[model samples]
Structures are given as structure tokens and as C-alpha cells.
Target: MKKIFTLIATALMTVGANAQDAKFQIYTEVEPNTYAVTTNLDAVKAEFGEEKVTEAWGMGVWLPVDYVLIDNANLKATTAVDLTPIYFSGNKFTDMQKEFPAYTGYMNLGSSLGQNNWKGTEVIEDLTALKAAYHGAVSVFPKVDGTLSFGVYAGDNSRSIGIFNMATEDEMNEEIFMGAWANYYNFRHDGVEAAPDGTIPAKGSAAYVSAEVKAGRQYILVGGANKNLTMHQIKFVPAQGTGINNAGVSSEKTIEAVYTLGGIRTNGIGKGVNIVKYSDGTTVKIVK
Candidate 1:
């Protein structure tokens, strides 16, 4: 009996090894001017043998593995790239001017249809670089500076307010990125492994969405606009539900009390002008 069990285990192990070795198979024609292999036999080449395989992350996250595999092997693989337009007109422009009721020139948000689009992969490390890139792509206003809100268009009608404030602003930061807005979410390959969360219909031949990172250039969509769309400030205290949200809350939070300005309290006396206490033991106050 022991001998029979050993034999069965060895057979299973061999089968598993073969399956792993032959992961994914294909048979296709090599195309002209298409790069499927590289000339270098020395260096590691998961990227490319011809030109470098630039991985364009449309949603800024998620892997493009299937796309990379096909592009890597196909003889006539042409890269699919999309340029995202950055619009300059503020929807609230007319209101702001009305509030001031004086600065007559700030009324209209001049060029509306378009400002210009970037390839989404543009290296915009900060506001300065972002402004410079937008201008470099195409300059409409004399200066793409503050007082101007920014929005990005993803073809069709989908859009996201890229910037609310250029000065000390930092949109697309780490905090609300992965959860709130999965910007440019796309598949790594044309036919990547099926995902649990992918939009698979009953027929199993439908579109999908995933949040993994791989290689190659593919397009994904951001679900909704990022909150407030304001970037990071230079030196301001962090605001609630804005700064980096690292963990999830398991329980409900209850507010303890709210104090009237300059009013005395018996339970917990605060020395400031106004004070607020919460079940989480958090105190918000304005100190003179």
C-alpha cells in the first residue's frame, strides 16, 4: 500500500511540473517590422528584443501582462496609445466672478472645448511640471497658472477634475487613488487570466476590470472623480478624509459633544474658543 501511494505521488508531481513548464501555448506567423525577439543573448529580456516595450498604464495601476505577451510574440503588433486632453475652463467661473462682482475679466472661462491632452504617462511629479507639460503640449492661455482649475478627459464623455489648486496642489496622490479612483484602469493583455472582479457576463465573454500591475500599454478607466481634486499643500495641517487613508474602520464612531464658542463645559473643559469632542477621543478646536 505504501509503495502504491509513493508511485501515485510521483506521477502527480510529474504532471504538475509539465503543466507549469508549458504554461500558455501559441502558434502564429511572425510579421515583418514587428519585434517578437531581441538580438541580445546576454542581458535579461522580459521587456523587449527589438525596441523597449514601454508599459503604458492607462488607469495608472493594473498589469498589462496578456497585452505584453501578445505584443511580444505577434509579428505585427502595433502599440495602442491614447492621449488624454486637459481642459482649462472652470464650471464655477461665472459664480466666482459674481461673488466678487468686481473683477469683470474673470467671468468667462475662455477656451472651453479643449486645452490639450497628454498620454497619461507623462511624468508630472508636481504642479510645476504638470503646468509646464500642459503648456508644452499646446498653449491656449497666456499662462497656465493658478486661479485656473484643471480637468482631464478620457475620450467619449468620462472625465476627472485633475487639479483644483495648482499652488501646493497634489492630485492623484496615494491616499484616495486605489480606492476612490482607479485612474486609467485597463488590462495588461488582450486575454489575461480571468479575474474574480472582472465584468464577466453570463456568457463569460465580456469586458473586465482588475487592480494588478504587470507590463505593456493598456487603457483602464477611473470609476469616479477624485475627492475635491486638490493636490498636496506645502505646510498645512492635514484635513479629515483628505490626507493618506491607510486603513479601514471596523466600528462606528460616535460624536461626544459640541461646545458653544466661549461657553463653559462640565464634563471636559477646553481652554480654546470652540471645541468638539468625538467618541474616538478626537478633539477639534480653534486656538487663538
Candidate 2:
């Protein structure tokens, strides 16, 4: 019985070894630019029949393996190489100005696109060189009366870097002063008031119409005109239903409250009363 068991085990091991050494029959094509062989299973099936081809798998299409049946066979192989060169294209400021005339003046001045000056004068030969010469910078601006106000300047020449200031007087030297002023005016006018209870009341509430509140700070214009009024900050409370108590309580109880730092009396008024109050408790009213 021991002899019989030994014979059975030896037979199984021999079978496993034969299976491991079995070579898959495959048809190969030599690559034109490499010392590699590509197997075409479908072609092999058509030429040698499906039964003879058995199973087929691709080694690699570009650079396959070099098969050597004999140990003394001399076979050499090479890998794919990239020889492409990287090139850098500078900011096309001239093209931008010519193509978009309205924006051309600013683009040419180098105040609206990218950095004003590049460290290198030669065209960037690679990504590494371009990154070293040109990079972005981040700047922070404190809010005017707790309101964020920031500007960006981009240029290709030395004069491209425009002067920046926290105050309007400092911006006088800027060539685009008028444009900046207009932008600031638009931002100020678009502001909405906050409720006395420190919340943004409804659109028709006093808080919504009086002053614009953001974060924990409030803003109000002192003068009627943009140039006259310096932005001021104040604390605010949220005025909701029954939150505000003033004249005509029964008739205006539903309105919200928005208190300002200064009086509405000014040299030049724009449209409505600069000082706004919620006459109706549920609504906001602009009053001088």
C-alpha cells in the first residue's frame, strides 16, 4: 500500500510540472523600430486554426519582450524615449489690446492680466524655467469698515505695477483712478442695510433699506456723494416682529430697525434720505 501511494503522488507532481512548463503556441511579429515581438492571437487562429492557437495574450504593442529559446542566443532591446522640447509663450498683451480695444488700454498698461515684469528676458525653454521666472502672488486687504475691498494689477513692463492704497487719496497717482473710483462707488451703492436685531431683515424692512451689514460690522455713508462720505463701521441689532419700538408703534410695528453712525444731513444727496428708519415696524423707510 505504501509503494502504491508513493507512485500516485509522483504521478501528480510530474503532471503539475508538465503543466507549468507548457508553452503557449503564439504567432509573433517583430516590431520595425524595436527588438520586440508582438503576438497576433487572431492571426494565429486564422492561420493555424483555433484548436492549435489555444490561448493568446499580447505582451506589448510598442515594446514587447525578447524571447530566447536558447541560453547562448544574443538578444538586445531598447526602451521608448521622449525627445520633445518644452517651449514657453509669454503673455500676449499686444494681441489682447488689439483684439479687445475697450480692454486694450488696461491690458497694455499691464494692470488687468498678469504679473507686470518677468525676471527672464528670453523665451521660456521649459516649464521649470517658466515657473522660476513667473509666479502668482497673493495679497490681503483689510475691509473698509469691515467690508472687503481689493484690487489686482497685472503688467508685462516695469511701469505695469500700479500703485495700491487703502485710502482713496493714495490712489490719485494711479492712471486708472477713475475706473477704480467708479468700481468702488458701485460697490457702496449696492450695499443693503441690516436689522437692529443684528439680522438681515426683509427687503422692505428698515434694516434692509438703511445700511448694509456683513459679518458683525455695519457700514453707513456720512456724506451724500461718494467722494464726501468716508465709510464708517457701527454695531447693529436684529429687529424682527415686536423687536423695534418707536413712533406710530401700532401702524409701524412690523418694520425693522437700521441705525447709522451719522446724521443724513449732507452737502449732496443722491436720491432718497441718507438716514433711513423703519417708520412701519414691519417695513423700512428712508428718512432724512
Candidate 3:
């Protein structure tokens, strides 16, 4: 009786350990491009060396002229795999550059109208161009099954953005509803006016949100609208092992048998490290 009780307790503990999830945060690694925090051009030029600031900006902008390219050499979230850059027609080639750390919302650069002069009719500038500076997208491909959580810079007003898990790149052609910080209808910039939406975060804070993601699927964070939204600190937390094979093959193969790490046959997955045998004769270790 005593031995049986001890075994049951051990099994419970093992299951708890196996159920633990791990979170990995991805950051923009390129020099002078910290995502979560905002910085000025002077600081960027100082840190990124003396290679003419405008020239550097031109190179960075021109490289991703057709599609979004994010450097992921320091990625530790899951099995590191090359992610394809996603392109959007809204992204236009112009002198306007998408500065890192801060996105000052889409503005009417051509109109010379300032945010402070929104009410004053000083020739209301065209603050309505759907420029890619505020409409860029980031793509993430995870080898492990997990959910995604990310933070976007939020100001006194609500900014619009979207998160989508797509099976193919072609699906990106469709539209996605704003997933976080939907637009605030009121004119409230610089904390002069109260945020119309109660859910809007305090001034200069990050609004964090979560989304479900599957293994081997392409997930994109799209700048859905011209609301001055900025993305940062994209993270993926593994939930459970999906049936993806070690060779990067995603399969829904039926389970034929299960066993413990020590090769002890088990009726079903219990705890600790589980050796799962698939109907196709492939075996994989799943923790859970």
C-alpha cells in the first residue's frame, strides 16, 4: 500500500513538470534598432557609427522595398528556420522611413499640417495617406507549437494593428480586423484630451496582447491601419508538443503507442518525457 501511494505521488509530480510551458521573446537585433524603446536619430547615428544617417536609412529602407525583412540571427524561441519576407501593396517607396523604437503615426508630410493644429483650419493637411511606414508587417515562423504574445507602443490614443496566423503567403492578400488597440475616434494626442476608449493604456505604455499559433504556420503582425501603431517584444510560449517531426515535417499521424523515457509501456501520455510512436513508425519525444 505504501509503495503504491508513493508511485501515484511521483506520477502527479512528473505530470506537473511536463505541463510547464516556456516563453521566448524575440527582439530586433540589428544595431540601433531596439524595438520596445524609442530613441532619436542623433542617438541612433551615435550608436550605429558615422556612416551618413540618411544613407543608412536609405539602405535599410531600400533592402525591404518590396517586402518586410527582419533580422532573426539571435532567435531562441524555437527551432531556427528561415522566415520569408511578406509584402503588402500599401507599402510605398518614398523618402519617409519607418523609424525603429517609435512609430509617430501616419501624418500628412506633404500637407505640413501638425497634430496640434488639427482643429485650427490652417489648410488641413492630407493626414490620410495609407503609407507603409505605419502599415508594415512582421512575419514569424515557429517550429514548436505555441501561442504568441507581443507588445505594441501605445500612446494617449488608440492605434490599430492586426495579428494573423496564415497557412500560405497568398492568404495575406485578404484583410484582417484590427486585433489590438482599435482606433480612438476622439482627437486626443499628447494627453491633452482624455482617451475616448477606457481600455487604452496610459500615455507611453505598451499594450500587450496574445494570439494562438500552431507549429510550422506563418504568423504575421500587420500594420492594419494608419493609426501610428508600433510593434515590439514579440514572444512565443510553447504549450504542448505538436505532431511535427524532427525533420520539419508537420503531420497529424495517429499515435500507435506511448511509453516512458525508460521504455516502460504506458496506456497514454502521463508525465515527464513521453516517447510517442506514430502509425507511420516514427517516434518522437513529447514532454507532457
The best candidate by TM-score is: 3
Off by over 4 Å in 3: 1-52, 55-131, 169-198, 241-288
Please say which candidate is ahead in TM-score: 1 or 2: 1
lDDT of 1 by residue, 88-142 (tens): 1233323323332221111111112122232244322221222211111111111
Q: Candidate 3's C-alpha lDDT?
A: 0.35
User: What RMSD value applies to candidate 2?
Assistant: 37.2
Candidate 2 Cα errors over 4 Å, as ranges: 1-170, 179-204, 207-288
Off by over 4 Å in 1: 1-114, 126-128, 131-160, 163-252, 260-275, 283-288
Worst 10 contiguous positions by lDDT, candidate 2: 4-13
lDDT of 3 by residue, 1-288 (tens): 011000100001111233222111112212221222112244334433446445444222111211212222111221111121111112221211332312311211111122221221121111122233313444455555666655554455544343444334233223232112211112222445344563544455545556666665655443324344444445555555543323112355577777664556689867554555566554444443
* Local accuracy by lDDT, each model: 0.21, 0.20, 0.35
Which of 1 and 3 is the better model by lDDT?
3
Model 2, C-alpha of 65: deviation from truth (Å):
86
Residue 287 alpha-carbon offset, candidate 3, angstroms: 28
Cα lDDT, model 2, residue 30: 14
Output the better candidate (1/2) by lDDT: 1
lDDT of 1 at 91: 31
TM-score of each: 0.21, 0.13, 0.38
